[model samples]
Target: MHPDGSIQAESNSSKADRALFNSSEARRARLLPSAEKKKRRMPRKGKGRREMAGSRHPLIEAVDPLAEIFYRPRTVTVMTVGLCLLAWFSDAFGLYGTKFSAENGVKRGLWALIGTFLAYSALYAPHTFMIRPHPIVWRIVHGVTILYMLFLVLVLFLDADQARHAFKYLYPDLGVALDERAYGNDCRVFTPENTSSRFANIMDTVLDEFVLAHLLGWVAKALIFRDWKILLFLSIGFELMELTFAHMLPNFNECWWDSWILDVLLCNNIGMLIGLFAIQRREKYGNEWVGVSSQPTILLKAKRLFLQFTPETVERYEWKMMSSPKRFIQCMTLAAACLACEVNAFFMKFVLWIPPRNMLNTYRLFVFFLMVIPAVNEYYYFVTKTGKEQVNKLGVFTWIFLSCTFLEFLIIFKFGRELFREPWPPLVKWSWMAAGASTTVALLIWTVSRRNKLKTQ
Candidate 1:
């Protein structure tokens, strides 16, 4: 009143309300779990975050800050209703009518089936070892892989002509006989003009376009495998495979220099080196990852954002095949499976009359490339990783891979029976037997050595 601002006294109700609120908050804090309470007490950034992450399993990747959006609950009810409504409006009304042939009807049905399967996959596909690049990508991988497996199974049921016709329906240009000889007919015998024509041979081999494909394919394999020993085994194993199958599939027949030098030493080795070099760079520098959102510069953030699909980390692997008999068998099985995959690709092409130039061939290879990443990762963990982090069962991707592998073999054996009827060279048979005996001897030696080492210990 006297032009002076005096402080007001505290209201009793307000004082009581403040005290009550503080007491309630204290109660809530006390009721929390010890871990939760500790987490809440920790600083939001730096050491606290590092501790939390360090406590988690290594297989669990860093969750994107935006990952909550992707975790929203999904249901098939809406999708199912939409499908029914579309079918009712279109099919029930006989919009297309009987103008659709039986073949057209079947094709449409197949397309619908494939679409449904893919939708299910996107919504419900099982997770594998790979979760980065978005789980949706791995879902798509699963969908495509299972579809490929079914395709292989379907091929087994059909005769060669039937399979050819069906495949042509999809690709249109495939059903023609391809010249299987990769190095060409000139490699059959050494002539003065032929064997000496190194320049022409290199040009021919390089120009075939498959050489480039092989180079890129090996690069991908190296990255997926991330192990030089495994890559070397596959490279040499495939060469021996080519030798064994050369009598039947002429494409495997190549000049000694071409097989060992051009294909192996040049294309495969170069690609693998490039891939391994990339891995080295990533391991050396990219081992530490700053959050994409945490980057100070826009350009750096954008670069990190773009590279989100790349591997979270690149760590080299040591298969240690000879560590023990069990491990040796496992490693050999894995390598053999890889070799089988390569054989399946070639065998399917030859049997189904799909030429190497066909888009289907390219697509098949691309599928294999995508699939093997998760497959190998899963298999590695299954065999090696132990205790709580161990994968007790084969993962979805690995199962799909094995299923397709064996299914393709069955298909080849069933449809290509006539090819097998041809007399295989006696040398090829004896050589394979010798290889089996050698592997057996090697396993026994390892077993004996391990036993002796245990006794000494």
Candidate 2:
């Protein structure tokens, strides 16, 4: 009986040991999956390390910032709203009565508030609507061009005095701001005796505000055409334009030296060379030549920030307008469009009584500069592409550009009826000049094509 009891006790101990072993095994089985999961989650070497680092560091993915900015656009939008609110409060209420007279303060405050809101709206409107930055700029540019067209259209319905009232509404001191200085003052006919005075006056004109405007205008033309020949043609054409319209617009009158030397040589020629040089440099160096974004340095970031004001893209334009008759026709159309734009610049100033230094004139110039970038791209596509692939319709910006040009002409006709009462003769002259210019351009293009073919032969 004692032997039996000893065997039973041993069996019981064995059973307890088995039970402990089973429980431990079950616990390990439950923990095994978790351990494996941790193993899988841990980052590995090489690619995995890079990915992990990128996920942790925002700057690592700075190359594609638009994507990141887009993903968390709500945060950006909220921040903009908060800052605008702060500005409004600070301007309107915080310093309203203390720093300025109540009426003046409130006026300034409202301007600040509204301006801030508009500016923010302009910046984020594209983001909210799911468009890219360059496209956003395109849209803004087209919008401004269209706005100007509509404004001019509105002005077309108003008489001269009513237009003056319109200007007064925008600026109360419009009359006082208007420069009543007559053009061609003290009309100095070219004489050898008065050569010194004439030279002095021409030199003075060379360095005046209009010189910068002329230079910039030529620069814009250079960027548009990217051809020295076409730039030369346009430069000569503008001098002809000034001569053509001088009888109607008194301001178009200029000395021979002023037109050929001061304008064509000093301003237009120099400006075109500078602009073309920039284009060449851009081509040689590529878009990332500055390496501003790639450097990941504070100085580079600041440089890139400043460069945002420059062209978003700079592509080398090889105009093959001489390739076909259709292309030649398109080029002539472009010349006409360019001439019309130049005419509009002068007429708008004359009609609106806006000086060179006026805010309105500056704003118009800025908007036009911005507008042409996209418009020219779209126009080039329309001109180059053929048949099924060609864009048959004008893009929004291009349409706006043409419309604005037409409206400017309409404005001049409507407002300057007295000034242009004898427009028939000038109109006839312009038509003849335009025909001659087109013929000259076509001949030049044909000559270039013939030379190219000969080289190929």
Candidate 3:
């Protein structure tokens, strides 16, 4: 017998007593909420935010219980509510517009930007209630992407002038603005005098808006393709693409030096190198997937928040290049898709007649850039991981992106009938160049793969 008048166990382990105590504790823990179970000791007066495990401030404590139900931070909920109120009050106060006059460029641009922001912000509500469980911003971004794709679909039906009118209707400033400077301005045409001024011409071209635009395009392409060889092929292919379509699109016609040296060699290669370097840096350090949810530090959380604007992962893509018939098909398809994307860029500008600097153009380009990150990931999976029929099921974003690409072509074809009046010989020649270039690159990659395999063996 124990001093407390309880029966003492005979065995040294006291197994029965231990089990009874554990069961009682377990029952108690089960009855209590997690917060109560691991309740933190309150800080005494004069203490300034002392270290305490699992301790939250009274404000945080009150908010967290409610936040758990919504799967969002209290701050996000509060900001969303505040922003909604602000937008509503602003509209009521006639801040966005005094009247519904379509001619007012300021009103139109303001309303468009405000409306888009509000619509995108409103997406958080549905995301909270209906969308799959994810970070609120992530879900909102996905919603915005869907809406953007739908917008592209709607645009596909509108004729060229109608589309320009649509842009003007949205923002009166965005009339069919085109920079009409002759691309082939030098009539001497590669004369010794002209050739002597090549270096000066290169310098002048470097400062040109179009040159910078070309570089920017290559940057996006490099990030998407993630292969120097592939990007090089694309750079040359796009120059040929420009030459092929120059008759239809006046902007495509540039001097030979401008096409090969300035655009392709200088701007495109530099942009690709920059993009590749950025990617390499990301891979070198950012591969360790520290889930945003698990991070507790404020700085890390902020970093994670910024990263929502970028891809979640940065992996080096390896193309199998002719490893098998399926892979060969995928390689060809990738090249074709890239070429289509390039063509879509130019035609979108041409068909819409929106200057590169126009806000509408900028917005579309920015959104499309965001769209491509997901599309590239999905395309890679479809091409490499999945079987034949299985590859048919594309990710949501990829499907929308492909639809947009096709619609862009459709819009160009339907509205720009006069543009398509170019002779078939050029198209045939362009097709052959595309095929030859892609084949040569594919074979080079195949050779590299085979050599590497032989070395491994």
Candidate 4:
């Protein structure tokens, strides 16, 4: 009906409208795919909430992946290799002995100072570079450092005269008792007329120094455990241990009153109570330790400033509260291990004919304490996080344990001529040891079972 040109124009307009509609539909489809992609990539809020809920502890949140790597078995193996090489050279050649001469004492003192500084620097320097994963590890290391320092101070006191002489040469009127013979001479003051008095004095001294100190140590253990029942069990179990082993060591042979009253009731209980009080206080108030920058107010700022001036704060770790029963058990088990360790020190010195005051004995103790920190940390990690029952012990702990047992046997066989002269009746000693071990295990199991029952109720 219309002209040919008008028809063509109408057809072109229809085609253009259809093309635009197709393009709009394609755009809508493209946007739908993009929206779906976004939903898939984004994490759901509920999932995030669950992940956060899973790890509730602040300590767990603070763990560094790098620290976990550094603490791996391979790294520990390498460290063990290095320490072994050092031990071999030191023991075989007596490298340390050469530094102890009169002429070299001044040099030795200087070197000792430098060596100590370097050792501490090495310990602390790593912290600056790396974030410590385990707070307990830091605490253990710090505790070991304190023990080592205490041992060194005791040794210095033992050789007070030599130390004083050395100091006199360096500076006059130091007025320090380098060789006072306070402990050694007083300890050896034995007489026939004063036999009863001497024995009483020895009892008193042992009670005050060793027994009381250890009882207090147990109290510290209880504070760490934060449970009264476990504390009671540990206190009793340790006494039983002493009783069981009394025949092996003359030192453990004490009067009943001395064992029960002085050791258990007075020293042990007091220490445990003090530790308990400390724990309660800490739990109620919470720990107040803050980083240097975070300390508030002028007074707190001043306190932190003062702390920096001394070596007191150098190895300090941020204190944390432990809640898990697993953690509590781990701590107690480690403490038990430490008891064995302490006994090892005594046995090694006794069997080796090395006086307790000897430098070698002091050095060994210091070294052992230093080694225990890393060892215990590794042990705690393996047991707790890794779900491992048999944790790898640090070389130092293993060495100390083996050395103690071996030396004990060596002394019994070689030096204890009279003690072993009479052959034991069939199965007497072995039976006694077995009975003691069985009793210990039974008591521990009963105690744990009772506690669990109480908790459930």
Clashing pairs in 1: none
Global local distance difference test of model 4? 0.45
Candidate 3 lDDT over residue span 1-457, tens digit each? 1111111223445445434322323323332347863576566753333323222211111212212444333545566776677566447667677454465645655655655564555433222111112335434556666667667788877767777788776667775557645576653333455554645555565578766676777887788879776777778888888777777777777788888877787888899998998898877653233334445798976675455355434667777754664576676676767688768877787777777666766777777776676677667656765432234456666776777777777887887786567575766587888988987887778778878888999
In order, candidate lDDTs are 0.72, 0.61, 0.61, 0.45
| lDDT measured at residue 267 in model 3 versus the true structure, 0 to 100 | 85
lDDT for 188 (candidate 2): 50
TM-scores vs. true structure, each candidate: 0.79, 0.66, 0.64, 0.44
Off by over 4 Å in 1: 1-71, 74-99, 182-184, 187-198, 285-298
Q: For candidate 4, lDDT tens digit of each residue in 162-207?
A: 4334434434544332222122223333544675675654555564
How many clashing residue pairs are found in candidate 4? 4
**Regarding lDDT, does 1 or 3 come out ahead?**
1
lDDT of 3 at 408: 74
TM value for model 4 = 0.44
- lDDT tens digits, residue span 419-455, model 2: 5565546575778889889888877888788789989
Candidate of highest lDDT: 1
Local accuracy of candidate 1 as per-residue lDDT tens digits, 293-366: 45679997788666666775566776776667998788888899989989988888888888877788788888
